[model samples]
Target: MKIIILGAGQVGGTLAENLVDEKNDITIVDTNLDPLRHLQDKFDLRVIQGYGSYPRVLRAAGAENADMLVAVTNSDETNMIACQIAYTIFKTPNRIARIRSHDYDCESEQLFSPEAVPVNHLISPETLVTDSIYQLIEYPGALQVVHFAEGKVSLVAVKVYYNGPLVGNALSSLREHIPHIETRVVAIFRQDQPIDPKGETIIEAGDEVFFMVASQHIHMVISEMQMLEKPYKRIMIVGGGHIGARLAYRLEKDYSVKLIERDRERASELAAQLKYTIVFYGDASDQELLSQEHIEQIDVFIAITNDDEANIMSAMLAKRMGAKKVVALIQRRAYLDLVQGSVIDIAISPQQATISALLRYVRNADIVTVSSLRRGDAEAIEAIAHGDQRNSGVVSRDIGAINLPPGTIIGAIVRNNEVIIANRHHRIEPGDHVIMILTDKKCIVDVEKLFQPINLSL
Candidate 1:
């Protein structure tokens, strides 16, 4: 697909890298020449330097022939105008705009029909990242959860703890203890790529893994991972920015929320705006105040301050104080590399995660759970085992039985809360949800072809 992206900053750059890594034909446009040049030098993509909101810029980036047009510049008005123009003039098939403000236009897509601007998708990185963090806090040991097919079955991530119930276990050994729920541990991010392992392959402590299951069984899956879910009742958010305010609004629907803001005026404003939530006007940087607010009794703690360092520190402190779950909204991916083995519960970047969600939408028709684990085209995917009529020979076999696609892996399967690590003999059933962490771009489409008969559910 030929995609035209407007913005050359962190959001655009990350999206460009992920798209190019997927080997998708990409053209990135920006007003500044430096970031575009940096993108051009970094990846094999066409980068255009011009005013992103202008007609010439859109045309320069080949928007007319583009499969998708994405306006993600930092400026919300600029993005809105650019998308309106693109849809009006270029008639781009899919146009997605990034809206930075917390106040969404809260109307149904059908409501704004006929003469107004039509945006195919509106991505709020802050909302996705913050809400994901909120889910972790509410569900405690969720490991990972990606809602797909419009929130039917969510793909959840879990780490096999060295000391927990799954330690020293093999791919085929899980049924000995747990039963009833058919859970699949789709991919194991051990030594980076998804592995097709033998039954005896032990789950080490450091591997980050993903699983696919019915949305209803989410709590059960967390329990199986030996991490209990603490119902998030009393919550505390350390920032009152867009992420913090929006999260508080969502949380106040069910959970009691208390938000701490350093700025007195903003806190007063937030207190007025968020009538349900308790908005505190104070410094969250001070650990003493956190204790006064009953940090120990709090079910969940969210650190979503604008400062990345502050958010990380606040979340760490919350965890140390015995909070069941702590979430940090740190925007930079660089911080993730150094925090290697630390347990901060969940860490998310708004722009990065929003793009992650967008990429999943981009590959929606063919692939499921398209997430960049850390870097590069190597992705964590839950490919529904679609049986193919085109290929007659590759049937009832594991990754080892057939000449598998390059860089493709069959990670795990849920055959009635049973989590089976992928092995050579394991076969993908019609309803089996397969998680693949594949690097080969062609292998992605090819594997989907093999499992085409199975439901490629939304």
Candidate 2:
């Protein structure tokens, strides 16, 4: 597929990198020459330097015959206009835009129609990140929480602790521990290395385990892996930006929430808007302000400021000051890697979240959802099966019979809204939503092809 990505920033660049490897013709557009040159130097794709909304720029970036147009420039207006131009003038088949403003999102139902803005899909980074954080807080102690199959099933990542019941046990023992609930440990990472999970595989302490289970069984499964944390009550958010304000709004009803904003005017606005949250106007990195707010008693401290350095420092300080957990929103790839398991408990990346949202549209076959995990090296895909045994590789085949790529596992299958844990003997029927985990992203094409319908006519 040929894709024209408007914006050379993090989201656009990462999207290009992901698609370029999957044999797609990717062209990135940007007004800045430096980022464009950097992308061209790093990848095997074309880059055009110009205003992404302009017709000349789109033509230069191959928008005329592009399979997809992804407008993810920083400016919401630019992204929306670029998608409109791609549809009105170029008639691009699929048009996606990253819209950040909440005003547009509130009126999206009426605003994004083909007769209006014409965006086929809208990727809201703030919304995605906020949802992700909400999930983490909802299910305490989970490193990552991603839902699939209309929230019937979820894939959760958690670190194995020495005190856990199944820490030193084999993989098969999980059944004995939770006989009533069905779960599958799809992948395991020890010291940053992938481990193939099997019946005899012994789960070790400090290993990051990714498991899939029914949403109701998430708490039980988490408890078996590690000491389940108490429900979060006191929450502090640094940065009254979109993500922070949205998160505070979501959590205020359930948890005691406090929001700190650097800009006094924005802080006052948020204070007026939020009924339950306490808004403070001060620097998030200020020790005095944090101390005054009783940081040590806070259950979760989330720093989501636009500046990566400020977020990192504030989250680290919160951790040192005795916050139970600290989550920082880091955009830079290097900083994300540097602080993953450091003083910061969890580092959320908007780019990764946005990229995950965009990947489903780019994938072949009937892919319902695509989530990037382990820093893009791994992926959890929910694909719908189409065609019968004669025309599809997966349909009418048992779990063990299907030819899956290396480091890939069928975690679960959701058929008719019922969750079924993957078993070797169970047959996959047509229309089943198959949830899979790919430890190696290079095998993505193979997975896509496996789910695709065969051309019986050929």
Candidate 3:
């Protein structure tokens, strides 16, 4: 596949890095020369230094022969225009644009029609990040939460605690602990090393465990691995930007919400727009202001300010001052590496979250959902099976009979809205949505090939 990407920023650079090794011809375009040079030296791809919205720039970047065009520049107008140009002139097969403003209604057909912007896929990083934070708040003890098979199944990651019921027990004991609830432990990470999970494997405290369970059984499975925190009631958010405002509004109904903004006018604007949230006009890193607001009593403190330094400082201060859990939005990957394991309970990169959403479209197979785990070292994919026994590699075969790549495990299958945990004797049929965990991403091509239905002539 040939892909042309606009904007050499964090999201574009990360996307390029993931796709370059997948046997695809990738070309990146950006207005800045420094980032382009950086990408050029690191990856085996073409980089163009020019404005992405211009026809000459697109042509210079080989958009004429491109199979897909991804416009992700910071400006919404620029991205939309680039997509329109790609459709009108280049006739690119796929066009994806990153749009930030909430003004454009995605539900409206006229917004993306060929007569208008013609963007086949629209990605809103802010919306994706906000949804992620909402899921974390919903499940208090989960380090990461992602839905699969239309929300019927979920993949959750939790850190084991000393008090957990199954922390020091064998993996097989889960059945005895909860006889009725169905779940599977897919992967475990201790000290950043992947351990193969088996029936006799023991889960230790401080290990990061990943499991798959029915959406209704998520809380039950989490409790066995970690002590569940009390449901969040008091929430404080720093930064009245799009993500902060949206998250505050979403939580204000169920929890006490307070929003802090450095600018008085923006804070006042947010106060007028929000119905239940209390907007505070002050610096989020100001120790005096945080103490005045009783940060000690806040159940969850989220720092989402645009400035990475401010978010990190504020989250660290809140955690030290007695906030139960602190989440910081760190844009730069370097900053994320520095703060994630040190002070912040969770450090989310907007680009990482956005890249996960984009990967679904890039995959060759009919992938319904894809998520990056272990900071891009692994992935979880959900794909639908098609064709008959003779034509398909997976369909009409027992899971044990199918040849799966190493470091990959079948987690669950969703058939007609029913969740079935994968077992050796279970047979996969046509139209079954199979979810698999891949610890070694290099086997992704082989996995996709296994799910593909090849035409057989009799």
Rank the models by TM-score, top first: 2, 3, 1
Candidate 1 lDDT, 1-458, residue by residue in tens: 89998898888998887678666899998889998888888899998888788988888889899899888888887887788788888988888888767544455364223356577777777767766776676556765566654455566767666655666677556555557766566556675556654457676766665655566777777666555656668888889988788889888878888999999999999999896999898876677888888888887788888898988888888778766667777777788655534768667667657776677667633455566554333556665554553332244565577566876666555555445555668865655656655655545556545655544363
lDDT, residue 59, model 3? 91
lDDT for position 433 in model 3: 95
lDDT at position 153, candidate 3: 95
Cα lDDT listed for each candidate: 0.71, 0.93, 0.90
My TM-score estimates for the predictions, one after another, are 0.83, 0.98, 0.97
Candidate 2 TM-score to native: 0.98
What residue runs in model 1 are displaced by over 4 Å at the alpha carbon?
108-114, 190-197, 227-229, 364-369, 374-388, 391-458
Clashes of each: 20, 0, 0
Query: What ranking emerges by lDDT with the best candidate at the front?
Result: 2, 3, 1
Tens digit of per-residue lDDT, candidate 3, span 83-134: 9888898888899999888777445367987777799988998899999999
Instruction: Please write out the lDDT profile of model 2 over residues 158-200, one tens digit for every residue.
Output: 9888898888899999999889999999999999999999999
Worst 10 residues of 3 by lDDT: 101-110
> For model 1, where is the 10-residue window of minimal lDDT?
386-395
Residue 409 of model 3 has an lDDT of 92
